[model samples]
Each structure stands twice: as structure tokens, then as C-alpha cells.
Target: MARPTTLLACCKLYISESRNDAALRAIEQAARGGGGGAVVVNRFTDDAYNRVGYTLVAPLTPSPAPPPLRHAVLGMVRAALEAIDFGAHAGTHPRLGAVDHICFHPLAHASLRHVADLAGAVAADIGDELQVPTFLYGAAHREGRTLASIRRQLGYFKPNSSGDQWRGAPETDALPVAPDAGPERPPRSKGVVVVGATSWVDNYNVPVHTGDVEAARRIARAVSERGGGLPSVQAMGLAHGGGVVEVACNLLDPARVGAEQVQGMVERLAAGEGLSVGKGYFTDFSQDKIVDLYFRSAANTEG
Candidate 1:
């Protein structure tokens, strides 16, 4: 049998875990068994954040309408919930659920509308089957809400427990804003999840050789568009454990303003602070590399 010539899309799912290799393995196994035509091209795990990010690619056309990306994401979320307890979860990165965030991006010939549809389906699956509150943003939202907007409404940027860390469950029985899907009250052990679909985004991190997270935050603010700096960039300074802090950035428009620009700005800002800066790194493969890996994985599967 020959596979159909189809458009491709990518889904980046962030689950809460860096330790417990057994649990992470089980989650990946469950995702693979979910029967999605999707292939996970990359898995990035951050120890300080205690998070695992999976990059999955799938055909947007052919093989059962809507594909099985929803099944795969749902399977991962379910496995994560089973393995992780939000009440005991603590990390430098801010998050809400065992499955922290899931975002879909159109790739190659895939359309944003189609990817948004897939995102909505996955959100519905988690909301209906698992009975979890799922919030929608980006193209999946009716009003085209941004993920940052939803995060702000949910107090995602603020640390709930320590001065610099988020520990235990989110401090709300009932959500401040009604969820786009699922119940009003979140289940204690498995907080709420945010889902969305958007254009390709670049994840870049510039490390500063300093433990002062606040200084890092100042540099991050100055580098972000929100603080009268780079256009089409969103940034946050986070402590990555050790004596290092990172200005984690999401380049919304990498084509116009790439990682090099962000890196230079960080370097200049850190120099002023008397902090040495390390070369930044991307958290995932490039678009061309991702496409190559997807096709290779598909061929291996078909063979």
C-alpha cells in the first residue's frame, strides 16, 4: 500500500516531567500506541523546569478524516496525569497541568485553519473524556486569542509557592475565566490545560552566568517587544538551576527577526549588567530538518 501525498503539520506538546525516566517512557509508549499517523521527531527535556516537550508531525490529509493526533495527545496527557501529581509538582518553569501546554503549527502545505481544527479536536478529547478544563487560544479560539492572554488570565506567569518557583496545585478551585471547554472547577491532581494553534514559533534561550533571576528578568523585558524592544518577540527570564539564568524567548516572527538578533541584544544587555552570556540555543529542530525527519520516520513506519 502506498501512502497518500499529504500536507504536514507539527504539534508541540509540553508535559510536566524531567525526572522519572520510566514515567516518561510510559507516556511516550502510550502516545505511540494511540495509533496516530503522527511521528515524534524530537523530545526535549529540561531538568530545571521538570518538563518534557515532544515535537510530533502528522499528515493533514488522508488516513481517516482528522488523523489521530488527538488520540496521541490525549494518550500522552492521560499517561502524564497517571504518573504525575500536580499537588507535589514543583518546577522553575510555570505550568498548570501534568500536560502543561499543547500547540499546533502548520508546516509545508498544511493550512492554519486545518491545524486549528486539529487543536480543537484534541482539546475536546481531553475535556470530554478526561473531564479536564481545556482553554483555547490562537487560531483555535473564536476571537483569535493569544496563548499569553490565556496564561495571564490563569496567573501562569506568577509563582504560586516560593518567590521563584511554582509548587503544588494551582490556587483555584474554580477558574477565574470560564474555560472554552470542560468544567468550571479543575480537578486538584490534574490542573487545567491550555491548547492552541498558531504559525511556526522559534524557541530560543540565552543563558546568563548569574543566579540573579531578577536581573535576568530586566534583560528579558528589555529584549521583548512588550518592553519597547524587539518586534514580534516575547520573553521571560527563568532560573535554570545552577548559577545560570536564561532569557527564554519565543520569536513569533523569526523570518524578520531571528535568533541572532535576540542573542546580540541579550549579550549587550548582559554586558551592561557585568554578567557573562553564553551562546543561546534552540529547543527544537529547524523546519527543514523536522520535515526530513518526519518523512524518514514515515518511510520507516510504512516499510
Candidate 2:
């Protein structure tokens, strides 16, 4: 297979928790060896949420454009489901499954349509073979729905456990929204997965020096587009397992309102509550850095 001159695209797999080192290793090993002609470019693990984000890059050339981005993700998801149990999970981050969210992004040469089809195929395979319920969003859906809209229907924003945290699988066996693929009822051990394809999105988080989650939530709302803050910005305030709270944000349109804007807004909001703010950081690498990592990892694998 010939490598494309430009990095093709990336699929980000979000796992629920990282406490199980063996499970984490199994998933990472599967991703690295998935042989989908893809490379694992970055791995970001958050201890507070116990969530792990793995980004895999593929080549744009080579007729099929390396359909293995799906292959790689499928293997990782299988390993995750086999090793982890949603019923035994507890985290500050809201998640519905052992293998939670799967989002595909076009990096350099790949188009949204291409990754959308790929995401659909992966969702189908996961549903049919793995028997895991899957929901489609972004370009993966015929209507180009948003993930937040679907999550809202599933009651994902409410914390099922104490202290504004999510614990175990969802309480009900039935899902509010019928899955685009898979069985009607979500399994207790596996739960349901959300899969989608969209253009690049930035995952940025700003930490506040206080442990007051309510104050953080207020700041988060005031800084989010839904709350009439910046446009294309979604914010959530949550306890980060320390004497800290984070205003976790998804910058849907970073070019228009990026981290700088978010950081400034968070700082201003924290000041009102007499809370100090820490520097905000991104959970993943930049496109150029990811491409460089892909080249390096692909070469190592080829060698």
C-alpha cells in the first residue's frame, strides 16, 4: 500500500475508564496492530474521568483509502467490550458504554462524506457482529444530526449517581432514541455507543482552582453557545477528581471562537466567583503534529 502525500483522516475512540490497565493495554494493542493500514497518532488519558482518547490516522490514497480506520476502531472496541463492563464503571464524565463515543474527522485529504460512510459501516459492523447498540450523528446520519441532540434524548446530561457523577450503566434497559443500528434495548454490561463523522473539532478544558462544581457549572453555561455565550461552543463544568473543577468545552468552530476566547471567558467567569483559573489545554494534538506522528509510527510498523 502506498502512503498518501497528505494525512488522510482520523478516528477518535473514547473509552469509558482507564483503571483497568490490562483492558487499556488490550485496546491500545489492538489499535496499534489493527492492520487497517492506519497509525495510532495520539493517546490522551484523563484520570479524573478515567477516559482514554485514541486518535488513529489513515492514508487517503490507495484505492479504498485504507478502510481500516474502521477496522482499527472495531478491534479496539471489541477488546474494550470484552475486557471492560459498563455496569462496573464509575466516572465523572458522562458515558453510556464501555466503548463510549466514536467520532471520525477528515484531516487532510479525506472528505466528510467519505468518513461518514466509513462511520456508518463501522456502526453497522459493531451492531451486527458485536451486538452493541449504536447511534449515528453528524454526517453519519442522513439528516446530519448533532450528537448533543441525541444525547439529550438519552438523558445523558443528568448524573445518575451522587455528586453529579455517572455510575454504572444507565438505569433503564430501554433507550429513549431508537438506535440507528443494533438491538432495541441496551445491554447492561455493554450499554449503547454513539458513533459519528464530522469536521475537525477541538476538545479544550480550562481548570478552575476551586472545587465548587456548581460555580463551575454556572461559568460553563455562561461560556457556552447554548447559554448565549460564544457561537459553536459547548461547555460543561464537572469535578475533576481533585481540588479542581474543569470547564470542559468542545469548540465546534475553533477558527471563529477558539481556546483563547474560551480561556478568557473562563477566567472572567471564575473571577466573579473569586475563583482562580488555570491555563486551559487541548486533549489532542494539532493536525500537523498528528500527521507527523502518523508518518513516524507507520514507518516504524513498516520497518
Candidate 3:
């Protein structure tokens, strides 16, 4: 969130207790480390009862003239958030939001209600603070709630005030999807954001260690739209904590796509390069507590 100059606005953020302290510490630590724009601390609606961060950065680019078409036509929501970045050339993860959509993962919280309340409260604050009208969504609150199921809600609301709860409609290469707010920002020439909450989507990543970075990148690229791969899957190649070139993907449905599939795909991609995935690793997928599949898996693993 500290990445400055390009962050026009922020929402749906994950600033944990440690993050807040680090941000506060960075205030004093800046001079000790380097300098400038290193700390930020703000009061949330109910300080004692909420855990959520909503940060939006304005893109620094030629606005809609650049790559808004890709998002508009391809239905790649993250690009809408990128449109507002004001500088996609220097941006973080791909996103789709004037305020990005947020799904709360219950880790520290005692109940889903706890996080939902925090999310709704945070959204309310953003609406009030930014003067950007918004609707809080989830099981707790009921204002402007979407009635459709997952299949129906995917494109329930457009970036320009169009409600397309049903799919298979002609995609809008560059249409204005009005914000949930009444007076939406005049389509930054690109598009807009659809922010809310939903069931936990799987966050799965795969790492390759064939020493062929470009080859891994190609596989990642193929897995993502930039190359054309899975449906409802956002993918990319990165060199990070993983010891090797990794093909990271956000699998929308763990049932259809899991660690096994990702491992399989990477192995197949590595064939031409004569390399293989170092290890099968999976993490950061949230499933409802009511669904005991993972809980049982955890038990079996322990057994």
C-alpha cells in the first residue's frame, strides 16, 4: 500500500495488526532506513471491532486510451481497477475496482459475522469519506444485495450502471459500467470497479525449477489471459519467495482446479524445457466453515 505516486485511491486492503504497527513504525523508521511516504495510519469506523483495509491507487497513464479495451472486452475485472491507477506502468497486482472487490478470510476473527461487519463498516467509511457512494454486500447486511447465485452474480452489475446478472451477452469492448454509486466517475475513459464479497475463491500457485525462467513465464502467461489459458483463472509468472520460476493462479473454484491440476499443467509445460516443478505447494484458499471437506483433509493429513 505504501507504493506512492501511482496509488490514486485504495480499498479492500489487508492491513493486519503487524502491518498497522509496521506502518506506524515506518513513520519513525523512514529516516533510519531511507526517506519519505513510508507511514500511514488512519482511524477506522469501529476501531475495536473491525479488521479490513481498503486502498486504491490512481493509475498514471494516458487513462482509457491505453489498455481499457482489454478489460472492457475480455471481462478482465482487474483492468478496471488498473484504469484508475493513473500509472499501470508501475502498479501492483492486476485488479478491478474504482474500489476493488473484497472477500474476507476469517483467520484472526472468531466468526464470519465478525469479518463481514468489519467489511461493511469499512465500506461505509469509504462511502462517507470519499463521497463515493457504495453498497455493502454479504450475509449480514441487506442493502442492494445481489439476488443471483455465483453463476448469476459474476457480471451482475456492469461498470456503467448496467446490471447483467446473466452471462453470454455481447461483451462490451469499451462500455461504461456505471458504479454502484449514483454519480459514478465518468468512466476514466477505461471502465470501473465492482466491489463486494462472496464465497472464498482459491488462491493457488505453482513453482517451476527447470532453470528456464522464460519458459515458466510462457506457461504462466499461457495460463493467464495475456496468453490465453484457464477460464475464471488469473495467472502470471513471478520470481519470488518460491525458489524457482512459478506459475501463480487464482483458481476461482478449487473443486474444478486444484494443486494437482496446477502441478500437472506445470509438468507438461516443462516438458519442452526438460525441467520440472520443484515441489507441490498450495496455500491461501478460504472455504466456508460449514464445508468440512478441508477440515477432514486436515485430519487425514495429521493421521
Candidate 4:
């Protein structure tokens, strides 16, 4: 809906999964109306749907009183082998569910117990729905459910990773055997990893051209904070060891110089020099999502 059905008097923040054209405007208007903006996902399309994963946003809505209310988040990530099995079997985005290795970050003020509670709820539900056993990791753990340990117990294999080579072994030892689902039958689901909130950060690197001080300075100046370039962008020029120059920048807002846009800029800057641009982007938005404008204007009253 163009106009929100409910108008909150106090500032508010919430995540919307679907693609919304007015999200940016909505955030701005809401903030102006006393509601703060949220950590929203920005997406781009590649001629198809490439649903990678979701991002965790902290502190949805700021509390009116003193300190802001800590954002209570709940999410479930797929196991590596399990995700690969589904993806390859499903032929979705290249699998290997381990997007990045397990690195549990402790929430600022919460405990593993709290996260375990959420995971427990999800596991129980998955157990019922998929008729699959579940494992719980960290503090809010179950009697037999433990992460990484659970996979180790299950003898999870990455057939695709090793070219159909069975790398792990089934739990021949019953103690290490995976627990059952609701009924405790054959294990189906690769246990869940309950995550706790923490201070999250977004960082990236954009490789630059040869070590031409002037050219490097030009690109950096054209793409930095003090240059009125990208908003919240912090950039610097560094000299590479082999007499080549690089442009280092912190793109606080990818919305300004999106991945494609950044690549183009670098290419244009380095053109006629037979150089190439390599870039990286870390964001919480959808991959197929394309930012576009949707304007609704009232006809000229006088006309």
C-alpha cells in the first residue's frame, strides 16, 4: 500500500521481506514522523531469482525513553552438508550451506539460553513437520541436541564438495548417533544453530588500478567522504608494493554506489590503460532486487 494503514506516534522499525519500491521513502517519512529507519535488504537481479540468505538486523525500533530497546532477533541457518544436499538436489544457488564457518557471536546483553529457547521452538516444529530429528547448539541446548557435534555425530557428507567422495562416516557409535525427531525415528533434519544477537558490522574491499599516484588520487578523491561523492563513504589511496596504486574505500551506503555502479566507475576511471576492476559487496538485500522509482503525482490542480 502506498500509505501505511497504521501511523505510529512513536518511532518504529520493522523488516519487510517482499520487494517494496517505497521502502526508502517509507523509512525517511517514518523517521521524520518519529520512527527510525531499519537495516533493510538491498537486492539486484541477474536475469533470475538467486535467493542467497537473510541478514540479522539489531534494534528494530528505538525506545522513547532512555536507552533503546535491544532488538530481539530469531533466525535459523541451514547446515552445510544438509543445505548442499537440498540445493544440489533442488538445483538452487550453489550449495555448501556453510556460507561462512561457524563463528558464534554473543549478543550484547542476552545469553545462549535465550537463543536455545528460540532454537528449541523451531527444532520442535521442524521435528513435527519434516518428521526430522533436530539438534540444538550453544546454551539453550537439548538433552541430545548439539550443533557441529550433531553433524559430526550424523556423519554428514559433502558429495558435491569432494566429487562424490564420502568424506565422513555414519554414527556407528550409538552415543554419537543423532537423536530422533518428535518420534525419535531416523534423523532427517541437520540440527539447528541458535544464534544470539551481537554488534554486527559490514566491511568490504574494492581493488584499484596501477600505482599511479595522480590517477589513484583522482579515483579516491572522486569516490571518498570529503569529495561529496558517496554518502558516508570513506576512501584512501595506498601504494602497492610492486609500484601499483590501489583505492581503498569504506562504502557506508552501498545504495549510493551499488556493486555494478562501482565496477563501472572503476572501469571508466581505468579505461585506455588496459586495466580491470575487481569489486566485492556485502549487504543484507536480495540478489535479484533492482532499485527503481515509483512516483505517484497528483495532476496539476490548476491545469
Candidate 2 wrongly placed segments (more than 4 Å): 1-7, 61-66
Instruction: Indicate the residue-level lDDT of 260 in model 1.
Output: 100
C-alpha lDDT values of all predictions: 0.90, 0.89, 0.39, 0.35
1-303: candidate 4 lDDT, tens digit per residue = 122321111111112111332432443333233222222222222111122233222221234531111111111222222332222222111211222112222233334443334334544544565444444444435453333344454444223232322222122223244443344443322322222111122334355556564575677667665776665565545444344555555454556555555546656766745666556444333212211110011112113
Worst 10 residues of 4 by lDDT: 290-299
TM-scores for all candidates?
Answer: 0.96, 0.96, 0.42, 0.32
Per-residue lDDT of model 1, residues 157-273, tens digit only: 998766779888866587889987888888888999999999999999999999999999999999999999999999999998899999999999899899999999999999999
lDDT at residue 243 of model 2 (Cα atoms): 91
> Per-residue CA lDDT of candidate 3, range 93-148, in tens?
22232333444423321344544544454444444434443444554345536312
Stretches of candidate 4 off by over 4 Å are 1-51, 56-108, 142-147, 160-176, 183-303
Misplaced by over 4 Å in model 3 are 1-21, 24-92, 95-101, 104-124, 131-178, 182-194, 210-214, 224-232, 241-243, 285-303
lDDT of 2 by residue, 260-292 (tens): 999999999899999999999999998778877
RMSD of each: 1.6, 1.7, 16.3, 14.8
Worst 10 residues of 1 by lDDT: 1-10
Highest lDDT model number: 1
Q: Higher TM-score: candidate 1 or 3? A: 1
Q: Give the count of colliding residue pairs in each prediction.
A: 0, 0, 31, 13
Top-scoring candidate (TM-score): 1
Better by lDDT, candidate 3 or 1: 1
